[model samples]
Target: MTQPPLTTNQDLDSARLREAFGVFPSGVVAVAAIVDGAPIGLAASSFTSVSLEPPLVSFSIAATSKTWPTLRRCDHVGVTILREDHGEVCRQLAGPVDHRFDGLTCSVTGQGALTLDDGVAQFDCTIHEEVQAGDHVIVLLQLHAVAHAEASMPLIFHRSGFGRLSASA
Candidate 1:
């Protein structure tokens, strides 16, 4: 087989890169914690399992995110894998800072990690490490506890939109 020649294009920009990246589907998750007696969080589609033996998971957040700065200060953080029906909830989390958890039902741990009641999976974790990557920070979380609903489908992010996997798929 003949390999195609690779060409570098100077016109590649963030928008184009994002569009290209959007083709890969990813699961959505809500990373939250109780800060100063209030719930603080943000939705991220970059959540993924990193290692099984260490029970590690990772998510990437924009370096400029206002919520992450405060949320990271907590002793523990809760990560909830959003259910297929949580598209609206995901949007709300990404909206205004004060109104994020307005109508959502959530539970907070003694350590201040907060998890939505109806997520597909929930994990209580402590920050294991943080690595600076380009314009974002990759957060590695060490799980202390976890719960998941085996029958639930996760909300998916692809092509810059939210969706779900079909039963047959």
Candidate 2:
């Protein structure tokens, strides 16, 4: 019998590390940008509130994502907080589609960013900066205009499925 030698300090496997991160509950956000006058978007759970005073927010996209490169080049960006009904929207955006905006209810902001249909919350943002961090680009944005939905209960992602908010105990 033969055995392979182990490295002295091999750190945690990235796959396991990612799975560990999946344990955290995060809000589902759709990052939309207009390209050639059409809206393109990708679902992300990386969104975060950066500041309250200046009204800033942040989200990270993988540097290797082709879609991110295309969307990042646009001047206008919108972060739409997904509703429970948006699970399909998230899947569609992540899949291959001739047009991501197909059948999506949207209205352009004053700056021309596409706001999703009845999003829980839509943040019209200006790209402040994108800093390279590890394998992803942390997008820093300044909230230009904020719109809230007629109701609350923003969509959430957990353990690989869409989640609904449980009433506070």
Candidate 3:
């Protein structure tokens, strides 16, 4: 098949950029912690493993995110890779900050890190670095602990929506 020609002179706005970026599917994760005696978090589809030598991972937060400022104050942050059935949970995390943990079972560490009990994988991490990039900040997290379920599939985010992967052949 012939590929379409790229429009070199076309302007790329935020909406167009988002639509282009969403062409690639990504796993979604919840970055959370106990703040002011309550669970606080937000869903991020940008989560990725960054390093192995020092055990690091990363996710990006928009410059306008109100939750990051609060959650970043915690000593440790819990990163939970959402399970395939966690669409509603992800929505809750992205909803009102006060109701994020409502009706959900989560585990909290002594250091204030919090993770969903039914997540596909969980990580206890601390902020290693935060680099400002364009309209977002890339947060590098140093992993102190990790856990996973052997038979769970991860939730996927694509084209501004949540989806589950089909079983492997």
| Model 1 CA lDDT for position 159 | 98
Error of 1 at 113 (Å): 0.7
lDDT of 3 by residue, 91-126 (tens): 999999889889989999999999999999999999
Q: Summing lDDT over every window of 10 consecutive residues in candidate 1, give the lowest-scoring window.
A: 3-12
Ranking by TM-score: 3, 1, 2
Q: Write the per-residue lDDT of candidate 2 for residues 1-169, one digit (tens) a residue.
A: 6776655676779886787788888888888877887677788899999998888999999888878877777777888998877788878777774666678888877666777867899988888888999999999989988989786777788867888888889
> What lDDT does candidate 2 reach at residue 88?
83
- Model 3 ranges off by over 4 Å: 1-4
Q: Supply the TM-score for candidate 2.
A: 0.88
Q: Higher-TM-score candidate among 2 and 3?
A: 3
Worst 10 residues of 3 by lDDT: 1-10
C-alpha-based local distance difference test score of model 2? 0.82
- Local distance difference test values of all predictions, in order: 0.95, 0.82, 0.95
Off by more than 4 A, model 2: 1-10
Across 1-169, the per-residue lDDT of candidate 1 in tens digits comes to 8876666665779998899899999999999999999999999999999999899999999999998999999999999999999999999999999999999999999999999999999999999999999999999999999999989899999999998898783
Index of the highest-TM-score prediction: 3
